[model samples]
Target: MDLKSYFNQLTTKERELQFGRKAADPLRHAFDVKRVVHAGMNGEMVPPPLAQKTWQDLMHQKVQGHPTQMAYFHIPFCKTKCLYCGFFQNGTDQAAEDAYIKRLIREIEMDAALPRLSGAPIQAVFIGGGTPTSLSPENAGRLLSTIQNCLPLANDYELTLEGRIHDLVPEKMDVWFKNGVNRMSLGVQSFNTEVRRAVGRLDDREEVLRRLQTLSSYNQCSVVIDLMYGLPLQTQEVWQDDVKTLVDSGIDGADLYQLDVFEQSDLHVYIQKGKLPPAATTQEQSAMFSFGKNYLEAQGYKRLSYCHWARNNRERSLYNTQARCGTHLFPFGCGAGGHVDGLSTMLERRLPAYQAAIDQGRKPLMFLMRQSPYAPLAEVIMGQMNQSRLDLQKLIRMEPRLKGLEFLGSLWEEYGLWQDNGYLYQLTEAGQFWQVNMTQTLLESVEHLLGGSSQIHQKKVAAQG
Candidate 1:
């Protein structure tokens, strides 16, 4: 059956859910709510019986052709939990951290000699966490040194240290630079002191700028930060000022994000109970998204991805862009996740299980997934949509059935979300704001069109009604 026939088979309500309910303000009102935090279709999880064998079999073989590759290291310790963060795993304790670092180094060593890892050049290395910067200089140094010694990093590798900016002191800065970290991605969700403190971010606005300046002054790495829109107390005025501050801060790049507050999260509860002001609605965030994009483009900042902007050649944001396109990522540290060959694995997030597994000379796997047959097509959808463009021709060439997806481009274009520029559909400012939604919907539609009916979930997040 053709895609249209498949789509037609769904009930009216399901069609509305899959495509959208058209509205005057399609960018916000077209969908009932944002569907997800990030966009991609689900893959079948590998059962426990086959998980270890899959890992061993994949690791035993050499990577055939050169593919863009990267590594992810998770540091699950944070000194203070930011109210809005979802990745926080554990609080920082000196003794726990010391032991964790030792275990992490051992984990790195375990994979060092494997031909699948050691034989190829790693394009990027991202050390992310509850707060990687929360690590003491000693632990940070130990981790960074081990990475340099263990991974076969590419000569032009982009090593990014991802964490909160509280550790921007000279001590941590020196450790990062000494170990060949060429990039740093710090979370500075807001430059509005009121907004920050309301959400448990310790540093005030002035201190944030000062520390960022300190890091940039080192001139050793591409210093990037994450700024969010639609937080409680982050009014349009405050949001504009945040953008202005970023331009003046002279940092290399930044990701201007629209905040997603889960209903179960502290931020959501606080606002609901009147402890904090309401966050911006989805429509309001759309306006903020347009303003930020326009302002950054006006300032000659390159739009590296939908939300990410680069001030110069310094911030490549390689790992983020490439990982979505099926780069082989070596996961390390507890709570880390990666994909190898066609399998995706998440290491044990629980410290005890992770330590026990590693101590027994086993990969600390929590779950392993075999990528669905649709993954390659989903990757194409995600990678292209992330850059605010989608090449229908590429999809059609990849699989003729994907031509049906073009109808989506047509509909979204009419909604003022995108434009046809010859061979590709370039997302408008509105489309970019709603990229995650569109990407998820399209991925599900692809499955429904080519296979069977699939459920598309619409979630209630902070910005959504």
Candidate 2:
């Protein structure tokens, strides 16, 4: 039978019976497949020159408005590339890293001097990368020192240093803690050595555990480990074991993500060549996800957001939360992405281009403002859903444009995507599984209602130029 015929054979109730709560492909119904939206803080990039007017306008508005609370610094260097990675990064080179740090510090100093950012107290600073911890201790310290001296920080500011297990020695972490870095996001991926090796992650499981234990002893800092599901050779048993080990290891928080095989990644190449075992099927992955959710909640971990769980309240992911909530972010360094005053921006991806821009005294921004009139509503909706809850009335009230979109709540309710308890709305487990797809559906519907999606204003600017 053809694919459509096969799907048509099953009724909605029958499909529910077969797949249980979550569909095999949660975004897919019998007749249609929903497209997931990449409506994060950043979107499609327009050349920096094309965005100059908009950039200046937004900067003026930003200075006149409330100060942005978060900033992100990208360190795009890695010791070795992982098989499933698709981020901009380069292999370790000491000289190149030193050069990058010097340029980054200069960029920070320049940004700090902007009248637009004057007196804007930064509440959170996220140092993310191919691996920020890959930098030498001296460079890392210099970077931290530069942030401290150049930027205005809130008294309770959060500084998160994202790292890998192999690079996280006590000495380096000590320097970070002393420099007011209070959070660590360690990329553990999986605790199974075979699975790790299959993905080109070479850290020993025992050593990772040891490092976690040692880091946990730093009462001044919180350690959050990232775990992945649906990886090659990852079984339900292995995933369960990984979760149990993480909880028992006494880490502050954990984030669970499904493995995505990008076309440019080495993992995709291995899959194409049949050199690695197949990844878990969609059904199997859904099962693993459900199991993880239940297991972690059972272990007294509070589900802070959809994928994040914390042992206690101290592990708030300010960067992730703020970014998702459409908060203004100042992006620094090569390939960093952020949103400021409604205009999405990304820095130059190539290291040389980025350094040259800094040398010539530029912000290194690639502008790509969200064009859709409903973009702000879309952002707010997705952000709330990411936390697994939504206040329908408040959402509508927040944006006048969203008032007419309230009818979407009824449609979603009919589809069992969310439950309305008179005052508030929350996604069901199945809804949570398909939240991204649902958010996209709503945003698209809004776009369709508003004549059509707005075209990139930069194209007009380019034409005029």
- Using TM-score as the measure, the top candidate is 1
> How accurate locally is residue 152 in candidate 2, as Cα lDDT from 0 to 100?
83
Error of 2 at 296 (Å): 1.5
- lDDT on C-alpha atoms for all candidate structures: 0.86, 0.73
Residues 232-314, model 1: lDDT tens digits: 89889999999999999989999988888897887888888899988888778877887898899899999888778999998
- Where in model 1 is the C-alpha error above 4 Å? 6-13, 460-464
Residue 391 miss distance in model 1 (angstroms): 1.0
lDDT of 2 by residue, 244-358 (tens): 9988898889998866555556777787789987777545666777888889888899987778889988898877777777777888899998777656777888999899988
lDDT of 1: 0.86
Give per-residue lDDT, candidate 2, residue 98.
Answer: 97
